[model samples]
Target: MEEANETIVAEFMLLGFSGVHDKLQMFLFFVLLLTYLVTLTGNLLIVFIVWVDHRLHTPMYFFISNLSFLEIWFTLVTNPKMLLNFLSDSKTISFLACMAQSYFYFTLGAAEFILLMVMSFDRYVAIYHSLQYAAIMKQRLCIQLGFVSWVGGFLIISSWMVLVYKLRFRGPNVINHFFCDSTPLFQLSCNDTQLIKRVDSILLSSIVLTSLCLTMISYASIFYSILRIPSATGRQKGFSTCASPLTVVVMAYGSCFVLYGRPTGYLSLEINKGVTLLNTVVYPFLNSFIYSLRNKSVKLALRVAFSHNKTKLFPKLCCAP
Candidate 1:
């Protein structure tokens, strides 16, 4: 009788976007699937080019490869559960599992954010001080920048992760959004989340404001130099190099601000999630397309590889022709 009264269980249902229209599910599934395939292909191609080609062994490409890997991991961190929720009527995740999910999501997201800023700085150095770009952005320095980004993200996000674990949840376990976003998670917790809210505000503000300022400063100088160039061709070349990185920065920072920096409210939850998904999908696709496809060296490498494969498959035809 005593055992019957006590609840014995772990894990809670995630009421994803299931309550919405039925057609929405099908639409979301197709959209997410398409995005996933493109993200995977684009990021993997970048990693392969960076690893196999000796000429791409530079600080810029090194950071680009790292960004590619991070984008794939970023998509995985959120998309699988989202895809699962879209298919399943009742989605569930354990308390510990949810906390772990939140941790990894924020950590990886923050790391990539910092890495983008570092890449901007790299471009600034290369453009303005081309003579000293090698000495300044050496392999050792690139490695250090990557390490710092990861560690900084971990240290900053760990506090909130701990806060999340400490909070109590007594009522509905259903998270409003698809994945365990920090804002939605805060809403679900029963305890007073004032401190967590303050901390989160500070952290998100620091990420957006500081990074935006730095990127803006770099671009301000970059654009100034481009304007001073007497030759139209020189100016166009400078602008073109800045275009890809600037596009990435705008997309990343804009989405980040929409998702995290804004005030948390019941109405905006779904919209926020959608914005995040857009950023994750768009950044990887655009980066790979813009930076790799347009690059002469990468195109040459791909062409060479394709020819080699073709030759191997038709060795007899080569002699006949």
Candidate 2:
């Protein structure tokens, strides 16, 4: 109602971390740059390895490659802007760009969240019901699952994007966080966002809570099956297969629980900014590290690739004598 009479703000200012200590912003810039580099490199490597190695052509690796691609898109959508904000005193974002930024970030992130649950479910099926794993997660089924994730993410975030665009920004135009999160975007609007916030809460709870519960259930079954392996070594190997994904799910959902579960007015902008940045950057880096270091296939692939490249480059040297 109020938005009908109000005009949309031309631009929004990102308050960012400038309100904090004097030189800490510089520190954050480099730290975040390092994080971005690692996240990009790691996720890229996963995609590369999965693509190049024919051994990784299973349904599980298919989902992993999609997840890896999603992370790269996710980081690209948010981190570059945040990195730029660190150096620029004026962190101004156009109304359209802000909406676009928030949309892709929300969409990719939600998809990744759901994708992780799917991956966990895949693992559970494999560990708990080895015979049915392939039958259950067939190529067609994997395609459907991936499609559903992308569709669900886009539809949900797009609805919010429309809701956000309709609001009038007659109030303060400064977003307290590094990027255009829902809370800060709503905060700048002249409209009463009570209904919007409620709708957001319901959607978030369903997505975050339901997905987390499913992941937990999958893991519970996997753990139970692990225990029945009879031999200690077999049990340990089974658990080790899941350890990395479990750790990532915990960190990601843990951060979301804190950031999203808070009352809109009660949120600490600085903390929310830091958490978002860390979540996007940390998980990708860790996923890359975990998959590369722990998975023998990936390491072996890398070693082979490297040796082949070296061999090509040093052919003349080898025959010089």
Candidate 3:
């Protein structure tokens, strides 16, 4: 009876596949390391390409580059620690550190989606208000939009986080998922969480739905305009502009809703981890390819950017001394 004492959880253990065999863990470590590097490389390359090539200075490319920049930091938040977890047995993150990780993770993620909505509206203007698009989406306006995307996502998630931070946490502080997401945090709390649950749900759902609905409306209008184009070349050109963002929107929204919107239990945490990896790691890697390969303009810009670099790097090769 004297031994029955509850130890407060000062730090949380990230149970990231601790039970897996050594061989499998090593294999996964390498794979994850490769994925993280590639994800960073891909997103960074896109941002670099956009920066080097002046032809990509338009509103569309600006948004794409903005997204690529955001994704670079976004992927960085969780992968390094995750990679460390596989290589070493010590997979513990302090309470404050864990809370901060969760905060930044959601903040960047929400910013990405909000930026998507901004992109959709950009596309809508490009198609719908064709003649006035340049006039409407001027440089100052673009900067403002970019500002809102980052700040808007921050504020939205911050609201939920404020209340979440106040919640009481007792012992047995092992996070089921790899990173410190809200779902596991809620599950870990000792206090009553129903009010907080509803708060988070309302916040997340509102943001996701608003962005989704706006994106749909924007795309629907864009498609309508494209279909009405009299010339086949004109229609094809119109469709090409919207292709990359549309693809990204689907991947982003699909993962978000499935992982966040639905009911979650310990049984589903493993599944959520897989989905989170896809969202953070694989998704960013795919985004770079999608934007660069699918769009002719980006591809052309990349070629020009690389050819210029090659010329600078080795003028003797071209000159043939």
Candidate 4:
């Protein structure tokens, strides 16, 4: 009956790893801090190499760069706060800040799904339509695809934000989980959440399934085409090109489906906290390493880029007197 701001709890305490021993919490704080730094550096490095080196001036690298750019924002949304929560006695996030956190995280997460789908499609075109790959996935089209991917996430998540706002939160504002995730936020709502549950399930299922089906179809055609290659070496190379994105697709979708795909939300918040920890933190950290280490082109680009920088630095240092 009261106004929204007055009705809602002033702040929600994020019981992030509070049950753990003080020693382990401090250890976790440093570990998470280190992982966050590495994730930023690795993703940034990918974007930098892709931008500075003309050798990476292609549709594939452009998409890869967009993905790395997305990861920077995606991981940033939660890792810093989580680190603070680990060390500080106050693990509290204000109501509006909590909502903003959920909005941005899901928005970026959806963008990730779409961008990954676009990446798979890019691979499909590159392999299946090799003769026309350059013309088909040109700079103009790549820009358009990247634009759609980013904008699409904003559109998809805006509705979820609306639904979240409609729900009333009335007290006991201690969330058992680390971050302001949908399920935990849902659990806190005083109103009947059947609609939100259904909406959450539908939206999540639609995004995951739609992207997955498209990716599968692309890979299926790609597989058939790759096998049709007469040369054994050619076949190997074809599969090799797809390995990185496919692995990423599996990790991203697999974690979501297991953790948050249900109509009722996750059955256990404690386990949700654990798995989502891996999802939010470790996954981004791994994605950069996976892309750089697996892709030969990226490795070569890294070597060349760093070597050139080192050479230029050496000249400056030697001549400085």
lDDT per residue as tens, model 3, 117-232: 99999999999999999999999999999999999989999988888888767767888767888888888898899999998888787888889999999999999999999999
TM-score of 4: 0.95
Off by over 4 Å in 3: 1-6
Ranking by lDDT: 4, 3, 2, 1
Q: Of models 1 and 2, which has the larger lDDT?
A: 2
lDDT by residue (tens digit), candidate 4, 146-197 = 9999999999989988999777788879998788888778878888988877
Backbone clashes in model 2: 0
lDDT of each: 0.80, 0.83, 0.87, 0.88
lDDT of 2 by residue, 117-184 (tens): 99898899889989888788888999999898888888877776777778778657888878888887
In model 1, where do residues sit more than 4 Å from their true spots? 1-9, 317-320
lDDT, model 2: 0.83
TM-score of each: 0.91, 0.93, 0.94, 0.95
**For residue 118, what is the lDDT in candidate 1?**
89
Candidate 4 lDDT trough over 10 residues, lowest sum: 261-270
Candidate 3: pairs in clash: none
The candidate 2 region of ten consecutive residues with least summed lDDT is 1-10
